[model samples]
Target: MTTPHHNTAELAKLARVLDRQDPADLDFLATLPPAALRRFRDQITDLIAERESRRMQRIGAAAKLIPAPIAAKITEAAFGPVLAAAIAGSVDPARAVAIASALSPSFLADATVTLDPRRATALIAEVPDHMAAATARELIARGDYLTMGRLAGSVPDRVLRAALPHAADIDLLHVGYYLEDTDAADRLLAIVTDRVPGMLRATATENKWSEAITLLDLLGPTERSHLGNVVAHQDPEILDALLTAVTDLDAWDTLLPVAAGMEPSALQRLAERPIMQDPAVLTGIADLALTQNLWLDLLPLAQHLTPTQLHIVAARISAEPDDALTALIEQAHTANHWDTLIPVALALDEPARRRFAALPVMHRPDTLSAAVTTAATHNLWSAALPLVDVLPPHTHDLLATTIATLSTPDFHAALTAAPAAGSTTTLIRIVLRQDPTARAHSLTLLAESDDLESLVTSFATTDPEIWKSLAALNSELPPRLRTLLAAQAASCGHSDIAEALAT
Candidate 1:
């Protein structure tokens, strides 16, 4: 047999191991403690129970407030079970009743043994109570329709009929039937051809909408019409059920008013449901949204809609053609959204083109170049030609060169149509700067013109031989122009060219 001292040492070591294990393992280890370990185990139990009690109290206090921050903190503490226990244990029946009704099943499971029939009954009265079949039936028969209906709303008929005598509250009965059985919901709806509007209104609040809709389905044409008016005028929650009722009966007239009154967010949610997956509903929402100028409201629904539905939404609000084009240009310039600008430019009308031309050059050169090039590419030459002067400097040069190359016939005709002086001299000089030619006529053109001095200065260094030829050929040109050419030659250290000019 193990000695007492030896067992105490072993138990002490085991307790230390248990401390490292989970809380549940510690409890299991407590049952196996040696005689000497009892004191340590008792201390651990007392400390844990006290900590749990404190945690429960904190949660109980947080449940009283509905503020988002407080609720979030309470949820973070994982206090649902503790809160449920407090509710089940409370001596004050009213507070206990409210807590039991609101606490979810997962929460109730966490509560200590305080979960009982009275608490479950109170929960059934106010909220959907998840309970044993017998308990739910007992609660229903007690004329506690709130708890009975809510519980029956969730459970099936074998549980529901056990307590209630008759299906007097047809809405509640339907809820109970649906809970007990879906066929029951259908059967109850079939018999109730014309329900009292008050029952429908109350059921609407309880979110027993399937029952309300079943009643509307049984209504005759005239009865349905009057019911639609009643549904249209109810509070938002009730009106929401009415929308379902209309959808059930395919009552478009009734759907109109309730859908119109719903908040945009709520309407958008309804529009996306499979049951409400109708083009007309989407169109109605779009029309309402457009009238209110709810740009943001239509955006989320865009992905859910058919192409035709999208177009209807797009049409409701008129786009300013000019503004759209202007925005396209800005986006293209800033974000390099080049593709966005192409269709915009192509679609621009004559008035729009004129408007574009009237815009500042510095603001939209990229767009203007694209527009002009596209016009030219499509052989809108008349439109393209005039845009050259307004294009940016490099763009103007490129388009002009392209036009001169491709439309040589038009180019030559244009030259004769509007003759310009000094243009040839300027072009030849510019060409010479790039690819210098010392031909006699080119030199003569350079030598004879008083305006060509800058060009002469530019070229003298390039072809000192050419400047010497020009100065020798023309004596009457400005002396300064001749002298400057000679100096340019000397600066280039071409003594022979300089001496030839001097002679």
Candidate 2:
């Protein structure tokens, strides 16, 4: 339609116009004839492709000469996706790693995700420790948990150690769960211990415990035990959450053994949690302890529980068939766990408490002393009073003498509990041997009895000093009761006690 030179000039002008305006602003181009528009679009596409190829060539050439620091700056200035593609396609892996190291860890980590997978793997494997840690934090912040999992096994131990402090528990758990190179994971966790000793516990508690349980299998026994120690040191709420997860998931088999390995103090802390007071939970733990021969391990921990918690354990254990109860008691005795068992015994229902008191093992003097001391110290006189009847006469005499050693409040508590437990004879014998200060309280208790006359007569004959002590209490005693005691002492031919009582 036009001469060739004129058409050439028109096409050149159109190209210049397209360049001056945005190539994307194609409204005017669309108004041109179809043939003209097609040629124009084709020319634009070819020119763009040629320019991009030349730019990449320059970048590749410049990359070989620039030091990593300068190269990092250049790459950071370039569009992120284009820079990623250029590095992946044209840069040597070693050089790429050097430049990546020089870049901001966060920026490089974002760029890394856009890189081809093979390139990313190669580059990540070579990142220096500091940069690797920075990248790990960036990945966590971005919630790129899957990528973190993929990279963790390939990262060095020092890098992981550096990074763990910055990691969130959720991300760490996610990575730990999926990391395939267990040996690498193990080394990584070990390094993590140096920086964040509680990482395993925090991660396990922050995530679904099933994932944490699966990750535990990757660890050796020592590491797992260390992790248990860490878990035991966590807050009670965290431990409560862990127990709830274990219960909800029915993962006791997986968890109890770990608990069994905890240090005594830590295990004691776990035992003292109110959550451990749940009857089902306590029963489950008890069954596990019995089956695993973990009574020695568990009893010390149980010793730290609150009385209410001990009561729950005692009730549950006592309700077990007689054989199980027998096994529990026998194991506790053999383990020298009386300090642990005494509280549980004191918390038992009357029938159960009496049943435990009747066990032949309770008669051993050392065992009896430990039980009586613990019960008295904790004010479990109700549990202790009943045991008096089961003691052999010599043990009874020993216990009567021991009761005399109690502090004032404990002494009064024992005397008050004795009559209710039908151990009045034991109390009477104990009173007969007590010092004046103790005998005064005993006299007050005896004065409440209808056999006040017989009690006074027996006391005057058995321990003449008790009458001297009772006479000292005349000012404090009710007049009528004092008169009765004096009349009884006089009739028994102890006019000395009668005369003192009348004063």
Candidate 3:
């Protein structure tokens, strides 16, 4: 795949092949994609391999006259590692394995660096376990991870298991980072499962963050989560360093799934980073979460965000296309993340809240109903009510009908919550649009509750047809409460309420 991650790994490979320490040095090749660069690297490797094969063929013909032992000495003494590795492919497999067995571990270790297992697969796999271990120890001592990483894929499991202990933690990671094939990387991780924590500590302590993150990108989700959890439990300073590494590398795509799998305490610690607090950074984090379908997994950490951060995030969320916003809300409903989502919605100031409420999804009866029901269940009425105030009248009608379905105590609690939630006028407008029976039920509860003055004071604030709304309003209210509504409306300059009530 041509993922940004793939390009990075490809660049690492290309850099190794060219012996270029800095990617910037290869800027002339920048326009070539990773796959093409890979092909180009292969072409160069092939030309060298083909030349070596011709040389090996010449040596193999000469070796036919001698037994394996004499050939091993002559080859080691004359041609050394580079030619010994090359000629093994042209030599017969049994002859090659026999000659390899007689070779010194030091000779073999140096030869392995020049070896292409593809050229002599049998010769490499047939290397005895003891020989493999000694060669591995030599390579580890030399810090020649590139060779170990290559041979890691070709060597037998017994050889790998034996070799694993000699390498230090960072050395193991260097091999892991250089591993070209994903299955090989997976196999390496599997063999050293018990050592992942130590490897992670070494990555943090030694500033090998790029290699650590590259290994993380190479892993599948399950493995990434496991590794991520191990990394998460490291010191907060270490986690902070990892975050800095991710930012430097632009590896949020790699970090998202890992973050999703972290335990709550670890997530809170991650959230405490100043880098995580920036609005633009949090917005990008959220965008990636939704893009990756990790909102459910990662949003639990949002409870730790600051209010200012939440507001800015909500503003960006409100600016998303309607279809996308609707899908996100539906996902939120499915995931029951209202505790996290509600605060984000409420943090939107009035103008943004109006835009959010006016969305096409907000107009859908089912969407509004879920919002109300979820708010109640999540005890987010304090947040949901302000949003309710700005919704179109059609949504208000559905919301009113939804409220009517509530049992008496729930209804009374909602009535009582409206004023404290700063949505008393919104509640009055919803009541104005309710059915006669629900309107009567609401007024009865309103009269019995301590919120009547709030009700009377806010009733005149509902939009459109002030006199007609007064008619619907006065008819359902009790005689005593009717007097209060009329007086409050007139006192607020809507003399029509008093004139109509006077008749």
Candidate 4:
């Protein structure tokens, strides 16, 4: 979780557990659950600790007896950082501090990496604040957030306060990730709380969302939501960059949760971003959400989209295989996200909409009822009615029952509030089927559409598949409108509609 593996958060955590070792091991590690991976990490760390202790037992006697100055000289000349680390833990605590203080901060910092604090607890505790502070600076210079993070618990608070300001916001951001110890991570970040905004701006500027998401995950929810809001206000280019990184890394697990905590307007901005609407990005997001079961996180985002973006989402979803679409419906039903789900299904061209409505899975009464509930809650008659036109009889009956439950005033108000004009004919059919008493009222409301002529004309002039749709509703149209729709249907060679209207 501390590193940017440009993969799912699970694999990234696996990388963290493995300390970025053996790229090939990931294939094997991927098969294990998180708890198993944690156990494996603990065993590996323990094995290293035991082996390190056995490797250095004799060095303690030599260090205490040989004198500090001589040892420092030998350290610089013979023992490198790794061996020095192993020896430091075994020596008498005072002697260890003396030997460490005599070395340059650069060398101490290098050795500090492997100086298992669990073993060198005394030496780490006894080390002077100045020496620790100096070494922190050296580690930061080396871009070694890993060592700083691992030993943060052992570092004096005063030393950390002094040393952290020298680090870049990005460095602070990354250090937060490397701290596996929750207390240590919180202590380290608490010092730089004021720097969070700067940290985010730098992340956006650097397009480091991969690393940023890793850190955000570790910060837990409250902090993540705060940062998520800040990120929402970033410049358009930042979102563009985010889209690039998220898709490339497939880090949706982390990013989508952060996105969920954003303000409604912020979520709306993000949903409408041009790059976010890219068909490839949209399809990839849906497919990834489906594959990873991230629908719980992704569905809230759909609630923020405007109709324009709904069209984009609908177009992207229309191409999914029936099985894929069915899976999406299943997920939405599980999440109770059908309010948002219906808009995209309805926004599809009539052909795709018909195909989607015919999916056998749509017949589940529970699924249709949940969708109707969401649609009613959101007053999505503009969207829900169009898709209802293609639904099976049972679903139609369900929708009619829902309509029957609404008062005539509420029903007419819902019709009056149609958010778009595309669903006009479908709305008229439903009005006649379920509440013929509101016929004059709904027709009067729809009669004012400035685009009505062209809208109906296109039914015949455009795709033949769409022209045939009017035939189903023609008989429900009033005398003049029914005649006009029949003529339009016959002009498009759909005489079945003309004959039905004629009858």
Candidate 5:
């Protein structure tokens, strides 16, 4: 009942809306009355069907223009089993490709089965993008993977992009494994990513399609990074499946760089996955982190790991050669990634912790300060204390000075724990740099220690002004302790401390 002119006007308006429909406009379409929406969809479907019919008619009309002998040779002699063998041996592949372009996709798809696969690939390359896309869809429907894989890398981008919606996820995976053109592979994947979401992950896990992983190697860096982001956003279960597959296949060497490109939240999600809890997996990731200098990328994720997982990762990091560890530290420092290091430092065994703290990269004043601050922020004074012993004196003093500026609870906690950890001298020096209030707290803590005499002796020799500060808090000290401290200060030639204690 519709007039052609009205249908044309409506189709033009629909085209404009489809072209201009942003997310909000798309949502607006959802709000249309159900009848109207159905009518609109039906109209679009009719328009698409008409467009395709007209395109085929044009293609068929063009096929008529090809010399009748060539068309006859293609349809009769170039394809059927007996004639195919004769024509394939005699025809130039380029001419066959040209003749195939004007033919219908269904006829070409049937004919290609008889053509030598290598010649078919050559022929496909010269076919129009749309016809090639249609042929690919037909081939997929026929379960003709040999043909699909041969042509996959040769298909034009617009053709592959158009064909993807018609292909099955499993078929895509099968063909993806054999795709030869990296650019075509990347474009197909981009389309898959947009349309199928988790198909790659599902295909890899459920089907154990290890060959599909090779597609990653073919992707350019930009495409690989984009795929990494897409993979990163997959559900944890999908990620776990992917992790298991990659580990079983030993694909970390290829996958890690993509992982390293993920945003922090996505990386954190990956890090916290249960698959990462496996010791072997953790070790592999650590090796990648060190080799790729991805400490900055890996560290934040480290914080979300369970203590046991962290310990395993810390041990693996510790086992790296000293130079590798040093380089790792240097990269972390240059990237200002101390916050990521803090959790790992806390998880290391004492010897490993000390080793990490002693890395030459840890000697830089700013790096050292950042490390100490991160440790302090996490209340990891025990982990941080060992670093003081390995650091140069000035660096040690700097760390101590920074620790003294912590909140009262953190400061008091560090002071209380230092003696047991053998960092008392370091803590005392840090406290000495503080104003009177902190000095008073330090003096009270030192006076209460069982090793008060050793602390007093050390404080007297190291910084007499601290000894003077302690003596000024004389009333706060026990009477017997005050006598011992006065004798120690006088022996060290601190007359001011000796006179103050006597008062």
Candidate 6:
């Protein structure tokens, strides 16, 4: 028979018992007879200590399962070093896999693994297809041809000679990307030499851009040089993937040369790809090329960008304090593009903003004010406050009004403005009026008020709610304030106030 008891009801009852009985609440027992409260305090302290000990025991038990010192070193070593060391050393593959598996899978798939030659050859014959593919790539990364040839016998040719696979191809690139010997790249390229550009075109039709790059990387630079031409004359979808893959300028330079070598119509077709359509990416490409001092390569694509991109490029080139930042700020302002200029201004701080403010476009107070207010709005206080003087005439009042509208206006204003005696008093009164339940929180602010004596003396009647507010702010108030407030209320013959205000 199934159990019929209500598990949820039992748990709810247990939780209610716990919530109603906090250990700190036992502090009230201090008012009880001395012996009784002392015993109660001891029991509560013992219970809390025991529960804390159990939590620490569970934490220590879990910590033992991990090799802490070794685990800490994993992130510092790049994937290539870690994986190659795992394969080359006499360590167990299972242990190595455990460590390597924890690394980023994308980097792992792309990193080289160099196995001990004899072990590499033996594993290829003995291991299954999946294991053999991993070991063979690692063997190639070692740049040992005899080992690679012997290992290749059992492996699939498509995996070795044909297009490299995705996440699966990471290991292949890992080998090829780091190889020092020229012959290694030569031998690697030789495998893909027989296939013409037609192979990539065929692959692209199948929406196989991922595999095509793997194959292209394996080819020597000369063989892959016509890629821009092939891509230019090809379908647009193929061109998109090719462009997205060019993350840096060196890759762009290689591809751009191939693109320039192609027919003009082919280049136009390549330009039609979605990757080339976005202004940000186009500008990023131009900026990247300029960074590499490839100004000539960047010239052909200059007109393709929007004004915003050109401003970004200007900001990047004017990297030093001299002229680039001024040019960027000017370009961004003319384009009505504050988003682009704000980053450049903040990047330099007071000196940069000072320099930018000196420029003709920044001369208008409103523009500089808007920039500062924008920085403040985003809580970039350091940036905003430094530009405070550059703000327009009316912005300070607007900033004040905006700050006062905050839910916790006193706290927010305290953060924005430097503390002043009179200002702090006014802010505290404003916050106290807004808080509907003005007990502990507002009472703490009131205690901090510079006019503390005046605040207390004005409340002559000693209302119980006010007494409760003071008491809740700190329990010590009951004994100290009770005597003085009770004397005042009794002398005034305010019976209701005398009773509530008494300790």
Best model per lDDT:
3
Q: Give, for candidate 5, the lowest lDDT window spanning 10 residues.
A: 1-10
Q: After superposition, which runs of candidate 2 have C-alpha atoms over 4 Å from their true positions?
A: 1-128, 131-161, 175-207, 213-241, 252-279, 296-312, 319-327, 330-339, 376-379, 389-394, 401-425, 429-503
Model 6 lDDT vs. the true structure?
0.43
lDDT of 2 by residue, 185-220 (tens): 677567666533355456544556666766665566
What shift in Å separates residue 493 of candidate 6 from its native position after superposition?
99
Q: Order of candidates by TM-score, top first?
A: 3, 4, 5, 2, 6, 1
Could you report the Cα RMSD, in angstroms, for every candidate shown? Answer: 26.4, 20.8, 5.8, 8.3, 17.1, 31.0
Q: What would the C-alpha RMSD of candidate 6 be, to one decimal place? A: 31.0
Tens digit of lDDT per residue, candidate 3, span 65-122? 8888998899889989877877878888777878888888889888887677777777
Write one digit per residue (lDDT tens) for candidate 4, span 1-503: 22334233345444544567544557655656544654665676668767767658777677777778889988978999878987887888888888877899988988987776777777777777778778888999888776777677666677678778778898887677566554675576667878877887788877777777666666666666766776677787776776677777777677777776678877877887876767677766766666666666776786776666667667767877899889888887886778778777777888898889999888777777776667677777667766776786556555655665665455654555443545544554454455554444454444444444554454434444444554555555556666666776778777776778666
Clashes of each: 8, 0, 0, 0, 0, 7
TM-scores of all candidate predictions against the true structure:
0.22, 0.47, 0.72, 0.65, 0.59, 0.27
Native RMSD of candidate 3 (Å): 5.8
Which 10-residue window of candidate 2 scores lowest in summed lDDT? 1-10
Residue pairs with backbone atoms closer than 3 Å in model 4 (clashes): none
Whole-model lDDT per candidate: 0.43, 0.64, 0.75, 0.69, 0.63, 0.43
Error of 6 at 282 (Å): 0.8
Error of 3 at 83 (Å): 4.0
Per-residue alpha-carbon lDDT of model 5 for 1-503, expressed as tens digits? 11221232233334432544332344435434434643674566456445555553454455456774577555655345323322432344565556555566666677554343333454545556676678777888887664565456665566677667777777777666545456767777776776445566557456643654666655777787677667767777677777787787677766766665656677777777778878988888777777766566577667667789989988888888778878877777777666667668767787887677667677776787777776667777765675565565556556655665666666656655666657766665565555666556655655566666665555435576668666767776656667877887789788788878877
Give the higher-TM-score candidate: 4 or 6: 4
